[model samples]
Target: MHKYVKAERERQAQRYRARPHYEQRVNFSVGDYVLRSRVDEKLHANKLRVMWVGPYRVVGSADYYFTVEHLINGRTMDVHPSRLKMYADDSLNVTEELIDHIASQGTLLAVEAIVEYRMNSDMRAYEVKVKWLGLETVEDSWEPLKTMSEDVPQLLLQYATTTSDDVFRRAVTTAIDSKQSQRSTRR
Candidate 1:
């Protein structure tokens, strides 16, 4: 009778596993970047809210659970696999046209401040706040340094010069006119 009971328990467990979506867990690992799904149990109004809110780093993991560290606040959390999704770096897309445009342009953007930079993290980039040649204060934003360095090395070189000496000087009208000539030649 005990043997029969053990066999029956195994059969039940097998049946449970056979069900669709059963025992299926989100696959994630420590050090992976993930966005936590926003789940509000309070009300159904959560549907109108933002779906995901992170590029949080997965710090640790168990069988079907993970620990994530917030990129912004450096907060940590142990979360179920269902709460997380892989963070694809969908931020920057440097087009050939954009690269040519950047390469041709001689306008120099000023680094007003290094507002908040997270050092040598996952992406290996610094988020810098910049004030461009002819932009408003409200237009300043956090941009990845690596993207700038790769796409517009000349701009980086120019920025490097201004940054080291701590002088924010404009490149005068000749540079602007030359840029205009370059733009006109492209057309």
Candidate 2:
């Protein structure tokens, strides 16, 4: 039994040595933009959050990893090649104006859909519950119908039409019509 086990181990070692080894190569060059992988705790406990951020500029390289600098923050870190993916950009240059613009921008939440509507405590206006992109149902927010009408007029119109409430429907229609009129006058 000892002899058989020894022979089997030798055969397994030989088979392992017979297979070819492949090494991961860094495909991106220095000065190229790459996104770094990260976990965010606030956004659905990172379950539905955007795991990769930045268009970090690759500033230096080592034998096994690359150094990256955040364009907006100017912070630097070393990251493995496997932890990064190329960020496609039409222009190769990372201008100071571009970085400043991006840095100056405030956090904007993207709306996935207008899920439901409700009346404000005053009972004079409607508020639509907004489902945000990359967020859970529990995080849906209630926004004023007048505020959302300008941003998502078509969605509000659709939601209002489907509901049986006549007052809410008329209010949505009025809000949308006013927004359209404002745009036309500006044009």
Where does the lowest 10-residue lDDT sum fall in candidate 1? Answer: 164-173
lDDT of 1 by residue, 1-187 (tens): 9999999999999999999878665766666777787655543665655356656678888875888875533557788887777874434343567434433333234444433333346765454465543455676766776544444446544555555333221221233345657769999
Task: List TM-scores for all candidates, in order.
Answer: 0.34, 0.45
In model 2, the worst 10-residue window by lDDT is 100-109
lDDT of 2 by residue, 53-133 (tens): 777888888988999987764668899887898985435677777666544433245788888988888867889999976
Q: Highest TM-score, which number?
A: 2
Residue 173 deviation, candidate 1, in Å? 60
